[model samples]
Target chain A: MSAKPPASIDALIELLAKLPGLGPRSARRAVLHLVARRSQLLHPLAEAMTEVAATARECLNCGNIATGDLCPICLDDRRATGQICVVEDVADLWAMERGGAFGGRYHVLGGTLSALDAVGPEDLGLPRLADRIETEQVTEVILALGATVDGQTTAHYISDMLDGRTRVTSLAKGVPVGGELDYLDDGTIAAALAARTRL
Target chain B: MSAKPPASIDALIELLAKLPGLGPRSARRAVLHLVARRSQLLHPLAEAMTEVAATARECLNCGNIATGDLCPICLDDRRATGQICVVEDVADLWAMERGGAFGGRYHVLGGTLSALDAVGPEDLGLPRLADRIETEQVTEVILALGATVDGQTTAHYISDMLDGRTRVTSLAKGVPVGGELDYLDDGTIAAALAARTRL
Candidate 1:
């Protein structure tokens, strides 16, 4: 609006605009929606935010978000399968969890080693990962990082770093589970063909 | 994640997903962002939301949101131009304010008369609007509702109801200020030609 809204409402809109996928226009709409449905949406959301702000914390063991020192997965005794899946971020770890196939624990690297950004292995908890292999009796490590150059570089570096200590494996290079061959990119098609499996 | 997050965090994401533009995926991303930047974004946002949730209220006179009984526009002596702008929702009022064109007070209808939804004049505060026209000594009433059929029907209903009480006006129909002629629909082209003004 040409006229600025009340200070509190304006502040809410500005903060909402900073969210990842929401811009100024959508943020304004969101603010209006919240204001219109105050009891049902806005007030409850505010309470939830306050609660989460006070309690949410990062897991000390694997970098996953938790309400306590260690994440739930790391705390579970049954999940101590002598294997660790390494990912670039907590979001990636969550994606892997959604697949429901991995029985081992996860190590969130926080980010990949970015040469341009000056991010190194140390910045991504690689050192901590090494410590976990021995401490947690990990016998295998799965690299579930992206297919980007940095991801590959990070994977190779970790493999070399842990050489002769544990079995290192990676997600297969193939078409996605529900992917149609015609819709795939050239690199994906080539990779799928190169890594074709026997029936 | 396969494992549920802490209850508070899960609740926050669910509430965020109910917003206008955000879906479950984006809500998760937004929550992750807030958690990652707790001090900078999350805490401040939560505080702002709490403040707005406590103070924000509907204007008794015009149905616009305000922190007090009367909205800022209704309280301002400078905006007493004896002209009232009628809009379907508070969002439209804010949009008009952003344009900085109108100099009169606003009357938010909250919604239009929707027969399918069993909405009627009283449902949209039309009676209160009529009372305001007489009490505020309004000279002109501008209908700035949408171009949809319901919006037009609402505008016509209001105009007829106030036929003798005040002068009535609708926004002009023409190509938008910067709109290209070729890209416009045929109806818009016809309206623009029919309402053409002398150069």
Candidate 2:
């Protein structure tokens, strides 16, 4: 038999390969899985995908995903805690959520202010965030940005913008939570130990 | 803030969490990613999912996946090479495909017959396979089954049913597959070497 896959299957595989962490091999496997489990898995997944395709939208206010204009977190009355955790992207927000420590809503910046990429405050949704701070009566803004240079720069700029009106703090740096001490590099260990001023 | 997700989102996550290799954490991250890229990734994925959900089917003959009555492999005239590589599952078939060695169609058994779990030949689709052997003029049957007891037992049963009418072979055993050999145990290494034969 010819080694090439059918055009429809090949298209499906190509699209699947574009997903994060899904290479051509993995995409092929996943596509086959979808096919094998067509009734119980593939069909349902397709339906859900279609439904999400049509209804999925970003939360205009906080940049979180939502089926409607606002995401569930933004819509919940209980989440109106007047404190917003600012993140560089939804991934960071998810990382924070996985910690299950924070109890306030979030503000996704979409991306950082990158000089290399020519990304700026406008692209990062700083203006919308400011407006949210005022309308939502936000009293504190927690900066949960990454430790990269651009992440730091974005944090500083946001901190300055909300200096007096809203209290500002950033995610603690030092030891990565789920990491073991043995895996830490000397530089990281030194930085963590050095930053151990007070709890 | 409220700890619970919205009803619809929560329902979606629950279902997503059940996908192979996905935990609640990964499911949440995936949903977030889909939402973030709604217009590009999310929308397209959803549409694909929907179409598949509606039209996806399983091959009645080989237990493989199909968008129609039979999977493309089963339908292609060129693939009717009178050979069917029997596998314990779709994943194994996929693994073989990745190796790019086999050039014939496949028969996904869905699972090996398990007596501990009370599985019988009927449960594993041996009846349909027996019928396929004669109807499809199958000349050689390759048993690419797992090394587990159930996998071996299934292979023996299949070979017996063929009654020496067709050639039967099994994938050579010994090497630790899908992983580096460096991580294999001494017993596994010895077994692999002992089973080695001239090609």
Candidate 3:
């Protein structure tokens, strides 16, 4: 598509290239495929993206993507539990929801506290989280942030901010389910051994 | 992404997943990324797709994608050099254009002749191509179709259809440029040896 893709087609390729997994080459292939199925796929996909762009927004309460002021989880009355699950992003919230456990509300930090990158508590919406804990009468704040150094540092910061006003806990660190011992890293094996309990 | 993406967002994800290289998980990530930059990416991409869908059509003369009755190549006067390069698809035509070696017009076959798939000469626009050869006073037809069995079969079918009306040639097969001899496959090595030229 070097010398002769039209301007509009080239623009489409450039935008598609900005997507997470697609590059210039794959974007061109995808665009060609889309143009080939203009009536069925391309038109519909465009319409859908337009609709989503117009309607989608972040939930006022949890930072999850929502069509309205609140996300589906926040809008559901049954989910107004005394506990709040703290996650770094909407993706993590979705993962927790898929587990079918944790009958609680969620607070999305937007990102973890990163001193090196200059990400701070204010940037992560920690003040809003504090307000939620106070107003919602929350009992537990379950931290499902990833097991990275930045994640743990953020978790500790949040714990200190709460100051025992509510219980602060985090997801257990151990061998993952279906993980073989031989393939498991040393740190994970140690964590699994340390966190061991009788079934 | 699993449990609670908005309906419109989910639809966008589903459509994105149907693209050539994107999967469901990558589609979800892309959707999130798009929503995060709705103004910069999502809306613009949607608009571009809509515009392309409304304007793009196949060139009436050949089968190349075009926004008008004829593609840019067909509209260009300088490309009418009495030489028509036949290709399997628009991508192949683009490849040729990128090489900047051929100044002649192009004929996109859309796909190779496949008896098993019931794809015949008419479906590949061979009759239109024949008409073009006569009308354009073509002195040569260069077959740049791939070296696949179906590609060769299509080339042979076109050759027989012309029946020596003009000179017909297929792309030479051998080790590609920048390809090392030791890494070359047996068939490619054999072809290279058989078609060796005086350098």
Across residues B1-199, which tens digit of lDDT does each residue of candidate 2 receive?
3345444566666666655556777777777766667787877776666666566566777766566888777877878889899998766765787787887888888888888888899888888888888898999999999877888899999989877778988887676558678988787788888987789
Best by lDDT: 1
Q: To one decimal place, how large is model 2's interface RMSD in Å?
A: 3.5
| Better candidate by TM-score, 1 or 2 | 1
Best by DockQ: 1
**Count of backbone clashes, every candidate in sequence:** 3, 6, 0
DockQ score, prediction 2: 0.28
- What fraction of the correct interface contacts does each predicted structure contain? 0.73, 0.30, 0.69
Per-residue lDDT tens digits for candidate 3, residues B148-198, read: 899989999999998779899888999888989999889999998999999
For A28-144, candidate 2 gives per-residue lDDT tens digits of 777776766667777666666666667767788888767788987888888788889998776676667767888789999988898889998899889888998889999889998
Q: What's the TM-score of each model vs. the native?
A: 0.96, 0.77, 0.97
The parts of candidate 2 lying over 4 Å away from their true place are A3-9, A72-82, A91-105, A132-139, A163-199, B78-81, B91-105, B171-199
Candidate 3, residue A197: Cα displacement in angstroms equals 1.6
- State candidate 1's TM-score: 0.96
